[model samples]
Target: MGDDLVDLSEMFARFSEHWSPKLVARLNDYEVKLVKVEGDFVWHTHDDTDELFLVVAGQLTIQLRDRDVVLGPGQLFVVPRGVEHCPRADAEVKALLIEPTGVVNTGDAGGERTAIVVPI
Candidate 1:
């Protein structure tokens, strides 16, 4: 399989549900994930790893204690470990998530909204 030819649009077309992350591909020790999101999510932090979020479609608003980040297509951000963050999309948003292999969506702030990490 060609990584360059691996289309995000095709992978994204597979899921229509919200907050459920789909395993996409991987780079080194990190696994890339895709999730369709809408509505508000609980604030949480990954005490173990930095998490990367790349907006693939629609819009994503990330809220922090101090400020908010608005992401559009091609925009990306990294949440450093232990920094509180909540992600919300007024409408359905598609995103590419990145972090170490086995990293949980909610991290140590676990509750619901967490998907079992798939082995690549």
Candidate 2:
């Protein structure tokens, strides 16, 4: 599929669930995932790796112990490794997540919101 291009808009239209991340592609040891998120996500931290969140549409707020980082479309934020953070969205938000392949969505705070990777 080297000649094929993955379209975010088309892929996002096929899924209707929230907080479920769908893997779009892989780059060596890392994976690029798309997630539809609404409401507040559980507080968690990835002890071994940092997570990059890029807002594809709508807005996202990453709550930290000291402050909240708000992001809109085209904005990006990287939560440093071992930093506790909770992601929340006031409305439906589409985002791209970049992290190591085996990293869990909820990190150490695993729950129903912990997404299992679904390759597209």
Candidate 3:
């Protein structure tokens, strides 16, 4: 089981929806997920957990209340707990999200864009 690998290419190929995150792997109590995002995302805050975003392909801009942080491929950014933020992309972007289990994607702002954690 430990020898098994999860291929990002294969997982990304199977999904095309944007903003929806799919579970890729788990370590201890943390979850590693892949998400394809484009356009503007909802502004929200995870009051209890910090969120990590690692850009796998394309570019991602995380909009914070103070300023914006841009991330290219191989780059990453982390939003601290209770910090309000919104993620946006000029084109389709593939990224990896690392956060604790049970942390909702939409954070405190619950709406239709909230991801349902697709399991692959």
Candidate 4:
């Protein structure tokens, strides 16, 4: 990690791909990631680690097995470990994801949407 301050806006502006997470910082065993999301993501679960979603812009809807958790800018939600969920957005949504260093974005349902996170 760099000693310099990270500008989220600048990091976001450097990328344009949806579903791909860009690493911004590291917190002990966790990674702070930024991702652009639109449309629907795959239904998946992380059995060992919980996933955190913090909306930076636009709106996000986390479609759970039983209910949908909707989040807008400045809001955040933590999807507990082993809970199935799919993230959806009506428009473009910029979000900050906090999870373990090697946690896969697609969890157990990996496919095309799986992101290889690289620092911005």
Candidate 5:
């Protein structure tokens, strides 16, 4: 279904205690998610699709195989398919993620940080 704005703040506020993800929107087969992230994520890679991370607030550092990408408010980055990456936010970071539906945050590597996608 197509939705505008989708009331991000209110949806985001609903899960203040959850560290996982909330579905924000869907464009064709792609899905957008809003998440409050802290600490470091595990090393993972999506073998089939590209993953986009857009900073909504705070800061984020994405560790890649060769270099690191540091993102701030209004900034975004795309980690291409099959590239190893890990996302880290020293402080609290809010972000919007866009990727094909069913692409897990942990990708092929699954563990405790695999976010449960809570539809908004």
Candidate 6:
């Protein structure tokens, strides 16, 4: 591991794209990422692993077929494997995503919005 600290605000300021995730750190097989999002995302599911979302700024709504899970700053939610979910934001939001390395952002949907996570 690197000796320097990872400042989230500084890392977030390095990019301006929406729905794209930037890698910040790694823990064993898991990766910690930061992403900016707005509007609606595609309905998708990760068949093999769960997705963890931790909101850092603004509000995020994880839309499940049954209900919507709303999250704010400092809040987090895990979308289980094989469960379809669509994330929406009325405005821009900054969030941290924790998932196994190589997991695509769009999961099984595989459309234009599928992001290949890059390091910040």
lDDT of 5 by residue, 1-120 (tens): 255668766766777643587887888899888898898889999999999998988999999989999999999999999999999899998888999988888999999877878687
lDDT string, candidate 2, 1-120, tens digits: 133788999989889889988888889999998999999999999999999999999999999999999999999999999999999999999999999989999999998888888876
Clashes of each: 0, 0, 0, 0, 0, 0
- At residue 27, give the lDDT of candidate 6: 82
- Write down the worst ten-residue block by lDDT for model 6: 1-10
TM-score of each candidate structure, all chains considered together: 0.90, 0.95, 0.95, 0.97, 0.91, 0.96
Tens digits of per-residue lDDT, candidate 4, 1-120, equal 387888899999999999999999999999999999999999999999999999999999999999999999999999999999999999999999999999999999999888899988
- Candidate ranking under TM-score, highest first, comes to 4, 6, 2, 3, 5, 1
Over 4 Å off, model 2 = 1-3
In model 3, what are the clashing residue pairs, if there are any? none
| Model 3 C-alpha lDDT per residue in residues 55-116, reported as the tens digit of each score | 99999999999999999999988899999999999999999999998889899999988778
In model 4, the runs with Cα more than 4 Å from the true position are: none
* Deviation (Å) of 85 in candidate 4: 0.2
- Arranged by lDDT with the best first, the candidates are 4, 6, 2, 3, 5, 1
Off by more than 4 A, model 1: 1-4, 118-120
Q: Looking at model 2, how many pairs of residues clash? A: 0
- Model 6: per-residue lDDT, tens digit, 11-94? 889999999999999989999999999999999999999999999999999999999999999999999999999999999999
Best by TM-score: 4
Clashing pairs in 2: none
Full-model lDDT, candidate 1? 0.84
User: Candidate 3: where are CA atoms >4 Å away?
Assistant: 1-3
lDDT of 3: 0.92
Q: What's the lDDT for candidate 2? A: 0.92
